[model samples]
Target: MSKQSIVLEPVRCPDCNQTHIVKHGKSAEGKQRYRCRNSECSRHNFILNYSYRAYLPEVQQQISDMAINGSGIRDTARVLKISQTTVMETLKKKTLH
Candidate 1:
C-alpha cells in the first residue's frame, strides 16, 4: 500500500474575507482560533467551531423574541434546548450592544 498525502487548505478571515490568516491560539475548549492579518479588519480573531447554539444567528433572534414575548429565562432555555446560563448570557450580550 502506498502512503497518501493529506493536503490542508489555508483558512480565510471572516471579517475581511481575506485569505491572509495565522493561527492565534487554542480556545479553552482546545478549538483552534485564527487571527486576521489585515490591519484594517475589525475582527482580530475568531474560532471556526462555535460549539454553542447561542452563537447561532437564529438562536440569537429567538432569544430577543422570547424576551420581548415575556418568556422567562428558563422557558427560553428549555424551548431552545440550551442552558439557562446560555440564555441569560445571550440576552446580556444583546443588551450591551
Candidate 2:
C-alpha cells in the first residue's frame, strides 16, 4: 500500500490580497494569526477566522449606515444581532478613518 501526502498552501494577507505572509503568533484565544510582509499594506496582522461579528466588513458598513439613517445605537445592535458596544466601537472606528 502507498501513502499519499497532502500539500498545504500558505496563507495570504486579507488587506493587500498578497501571498507575502508569515506566521506572527497566536491570538489571545489561541487562534493562529499571520503577519503581512507587504510594506504598503495597512493591516499588520490578521486571523483566518474571526469570532466577533463586529470584525465583519458588512457589519461595519451597516453600523455606519444605521448611524447615518438616524438609528439609535441600541436599535442598530438589536437589528444587527450584535452588542450595543460593538455598534458604538464600529462607528467610532469609522469616524477615525
- Cα lDDT of model 2 overall? 0.85
Q: Which stretches of candidate 1 lie over 4 Å from their true place?
A: 1-10, 13-16, 37-42
Q: Tens digit of lDDT per residue, candidate 1, span 22-43?
A: 9999988898988998999977
Candidate 2 to truth, TM: 0.82
For candidate 1, the lDDT comes to 0.84
Q: List TM-scores for all candidates, in order.
A: 0.63, 0.82
Output the number of the TM-score-best candidate: 2
lDDT of 1 at 88: 88
What lDDT is reached at residue 35 by model 1? 92
